[model samples]
Target: MQDYAKLRKAVEMQSNEMKRIHDVHIDYWKECSMFFSPVRGRFLLSDKNKDFKKFHNIINNTGLRALRTLVSGLMTGVTNPARPWFRLSTPDPSLRESYNVKIYLEEVERRMRYVFQKSNLYNVLPQCYKELGLFGTANLNIDEDFEKVIHCTNFTCGSYYIAQNDKLEVDTTIRRLNKTPRQLVREFGLDKVSAPVKSLYEKHNTEGDVSITVAIMPNEDRDFGRAMDKENMPYIQVVYEDDAPKDKVLAVSGYHEFPQATPRWEAVGEDVYSISPCMEALGDNKQLQHEEKSKAKSLDKMNNPPLVAPASMKNTPVSALPSGITFEDSQSEGKGLRSLYEVRTPIGELTNDIQEVQRRISSALYEDLFLMLANDRRSGITAREVEERHEEKLLMLGNVLQQLNNELLDPIIDRTFAIMARNNLLPTPPEELQGVTLKIEYISVLHQAQNAVALRAIERSYAFVSGLVGLYPEARHKFDSFQAIDEYGEYAGVPSKIIKTNDAASQAQKAEQQQQAQAQAMEMMQQGAQTAKDASQIDTEKLQELTGA
Candidate 1:
């Protein structure tokens, strides 16, 4: 029973402004869905199960298929749930070698992997990827679950409205949830719910779910320097009945961090919402749909055309089947039943045109960029050619990868870590490193793909330097072979245990040098003793006599 009037007003006014821009996004997203994700979002609760029949106008299905490929590429390349994709490290490189620091990080990584696997993060990530590529933005909610350690939910695009701070980070989210009265009573408890909803729950009403709007935003008025409470936490979540009286709130809660992660593919100038890859080919998709429809109609007309019949045969039946019999006037010789006119569909050119459009649409979505490596079946495709194509893709995906890191992957890790730490689920860290800021290093397949390019460069340089050694042996000394080995191992995502630290390597080299020095000294001593023995055997006296001394 907290008075959240002030906070509620802020959400309402901001939501109105958000709605205007959100509507603009809806217009574009709806068009994109016609060919890409036809039934993805509820979209104002317009209808269900009808999208495939109504707006799914693609005859080639190339757009829909390309969307799937993009999702798979992102999942495997960015954050493959099946494999360990990210590592934890301190900002200070020197601390990374500390046994305590290294051990703590390893334990943390292990726990994180376990939690993500135990949760449904991987199950819902594909839909999040699809929404990002199709709508230019997507939302993911991460919360703590006592049973699962962590929980994740992916919200359909356009179903929620979002606002950002000056830094363009999403700090506030308003979502319209459809929940049954029984669900609401079970979730927030009957005492905290609205009377109408409570009555339904008590009466066992079988009516449909109620639409409730919940807003999570920054609690700016609280003193962040002090310990956080539900009222004084960093972010507040308010749930109010939709279309009910003002201040008809169901529940008010808070969180230590913003739980929603809104990852955008690419944002336009000063716009909160993003413009997706789907928009690039929207024109082509619409035209392709039109062309295919026209082709179908033309073929139908060519096969089943309107008939021309004389009045004498107006009452007669005409069978249009393969070989049908029709009784016509016995004396009618001029005409019986004939086609109204000829239909030259020109289906050949039309088909080719449709294919060209299909190719264009696929290219717009960057389908060829990903499929080239896996789908190419041509002979004589060299490894160098594949590497060059991979490099090209890396260069093109540079901005996209960076954005995903900044907006998606980074936030998810930070939020998950925060939740785990609060529940005391992580391992203890070194006393000195408690206040140290940790950084995330992405080793996902996508990131390694980028690193793979650098690996090639390093190897090529090493080979070139080695080739020069025979001509100018000093060239070998100029190359930092030790540093090169370390760099190569890192880029390959080789575990630290497999690669020795610099200190260990330097010590090994020094020990080897000392052993060589000892061996050389021992050899010199042995040779000196042998010479003395020869002298003792009177070789010197024999030499002097031969010299007539």
Candidate 2:
């Protein structure tokens, strides 16, 4: 006996609470998106085409180009589609290096990449990243697809509502989506949907899309000791027609993990929503547009200034068109459509100001920082040198990148791994690695810059030790060579197969030492036997001399 009313009430309460805080951000987000991104805002029915048709406000396209570059830069720096930018490892470094675990994790990484490539992840990811830049908060749903192995759906900021737990982690996701009647029935089936939805479906009333709410929240009854199934799992999903009776749920299901990843760039204290660089630079964006608009008007006046005519020629029509003769009075010869106030607009200075504002907007969005690698014109510069050149930028983004790893990439990979494991698409883990938890290590370009600090430390330490080795060769004993090798391998992105596990390396060392010990003992025994033979010959000669033979 599922309490449909209770479930609906809980979902509505959570959603209402989320929307209460979320509405404040929506007001500004509407303005922000209008200027930079060309995408239409689909938050409300009234706001549908209102924001959609307002792209004319963007008199300058600098913001648009900067945002596009921001998206591409993020893709290259964080999760490059062309490379395996992340890896799976256990918390125990030694465990990660074990041959079996290493092979299994590699297989897992390979499979996950395949799934990502097959799915719409790479395509929709830019949308998510774009929303993140524009709104500071972005939601992406990672779900299972039988054919694709994994499926990704990105929700623009205002279209969704989310609640955070006590730890400020988003565990509740409520999406207000518009689905056609046919879509509802196809998804939940005829018998599962509400009466209103079914009526429209059966009558072929597909005239317009109807709004529905889907809620993903904690299953409150899981603690009541009910048998665990899809419906009774830890987190539950409830989808229902918004206009249907409040007591009926369209569909009910559950997930072992939170399938939605909601990432916020700069979350203020205790707020569910976040503020982004778009919001920060929105003032400059508007100023830039205004400046550009003013410049256009100035140019317009210069090209076609307003005209004034004398009373004598008031009856005659003025021909402003090109190659048209106006019967302007021979009396109005000096006043025949001449320049108005000499049209003095400083075109060069206005352009300089507009460019300055555009540069400010780009800086707010970290455009220069993100595209530092792409913008570099240096020849023969290694990746490390480029990273070193922009190390400060990476440090600036350190906090955001950490949050991105936790809020976005972590859950995405975790959900995909779960789907693959559920479908038996992965190899079984070794018994030794049975209980060890898998962790994701981002080795992307941005993360490499973060690790470069530690790598530099290692390099400096080795250089110091090399200098001291001639004077104090035993100073090498202070640092553990094996641990240094392990860390270097990890930070250097060395393949796991290239490095042996700590246990394996230790065992090999012990075997070599045992062989050396055994050979030394055998040599000592042979030397003693040779000396004994020499003593025996001396004894024989002495005895012969004493007997006078």
Candidate 3:
């Protein structure tokens, strides 16, 4: 038996530490809050009421729009609009008949798609984008029903720890669950159990709500006891008990492993949460935009300066001035007169400054690339040149793409596979593949582009080496044509079904050679028979000549 109380306490302590770490990056969270909710943004809230009202009246909200576009573009790239985000592979090269594995994986993918669709993952993804943009991290929880698996994001989900050995893998996770006592009883299947369980459920029903913290972690012992059954082959344990009912454990269940991992689209240094530094730039841009509007308003006022008159003439009707026939009183003939003069608002420099600030904000968000493409299109630039430029810009996101592959796409795929396996929704693996583990290969456009750089380098190397080998034959040995082709196929996202296995290719070559040898032997036999026939005929001719003489 495990010490449930002690373990729970330790997990709680760790969760508190993680929360403290999260609090340090609260400024990033504030930025996200401002992006989504301008009225409630901390910046706006901190200003005086009158000043905030002015900001509200003139706020452009271009920053929010830019952030939205950036998030959408990133989501589209990573999710792979053309096809699935990932494919399955195996580490074992010795395994032949990968076509069967492919079929199995395809079925699994189809099932996963069904579950995701049912769970409205399309809706959940936007929440992920919001979390990633603001906090630089997103969490997904997989919950199962009888018919389908549900996937959800827990942006506010708290208290998770990752193993020190692997930064990418999460070791343990805890989530707060709110439920009524009766609901808990039903969930744990305690309604039909002991009288004490029933009484406890009734007592909780009288209360308003109950909160339970469920913790999932790896099992410490490797013993194959009753608790370590085949159903829980991966040997992860789950423990849950009501905070109110501390003495009595609610339930203890099993899982393949902890079903949560922190997926970050980007990171800075070693921090768990690192938002885009561009957010600060966006805030500055907003402020500048407000100031520019204020200056423009002042300039307009200066261009049509307000009328000023002497105290005696102040009582004169303004309608008389608008009629262009102002009549001064006889007593104040020349003393009271209105003068018209320009205030001279220097707006040329201010306009230039505003444009520069806008440019900086756009560059920070990568909107400048889009603007460049748009301008290039108008200029009738060739498609090839535009593509080259776009690719060059994409290089800046190479690290982000890699992080998505490892932290987000790969884990989602693995967890989806695990869910399908647990539900028996996938086809049974062949006997030979019983112990084989599947690996994920991302083939999205973004992923392919990330590999394109290395592929280009390999191509260049091969070209140079082949040229050298033309002059120096020994140089040919330095290149491995087969390995090059294999790598090219992988980087190019070539389908495995189209490529022949080494063993299969060798077998085909051997068969062709045997057919050629058999043909040669048959030809030799026919030629020998013809020669024999000719010799017999010559012998016959000689014998006939002899008999006639």
Q: Rate the local accuracy (lDDT) of all candidates.
A: 0.82, 0.84, 0.61
lDDT of 2 by residue, 1-549 (tens): 678898898888888888888787777888888888857346684334453556777788877877787788878788888987899888876576668878888988998899999999999888888888888989999888989988898887678888889999999988887888888888888998777778887888955677889999888788557777888888999988888889988888999889999988888898888888888889999899888889999999998888766788778877778898888678776676666467999999999998899889988888888666776734667767876898887788898898899999998998888889889998888886888788889888778878888888898888999899879989988978788888987886777888888888999999999999999999999999999998877876779899997
Worst 10 residues of 2 by lDDT: 45-54
Give the alpha carbon lDDT tens digit for every residue of 1-549 in model 1: 345676677778888988887887777788887778787765774344453574445676788888888898888778888788998887876776676777788899999999999999998889999998898899999988999987999988767999899988989898876778878877888887777787888889935678888899988777757767787888988898776567667787899889978989888877998888888888888888899899989998888888888889988887877788888897777689887998998999999999999899888777887787555425557545665667776678888999899998898899999999989999889985978989998887668778777888998999999899989998888998877887887777767666666787889999999999999999999999999898788877788999999
Superposition TM-score, candidate 1 onto the true structure: 0.91
The C-alpha RMSD in Å for every predicted model, in order, reads: 2.9, 5.4, 7.7
Count backbone overlaps in model 3.
0
Q: What is the TM-score of candidate 2?
A: 0.88
Descending-lDDT candidate ranking? 2, 1, 3
User: Runs in model 2 with CA error above 4 Å?
Assistant: 46-53, 317-336, 502-549
Which lDDT value does model 1 have at 302?
Answer: 89
RMSD of 2: 5.4
* Candidate 1 residue pairs in backbone clash: none
Best by TM-score: 1
Q: Indicate whether candidate 2 or candidate 3 has the larger lDDT.
A: 2
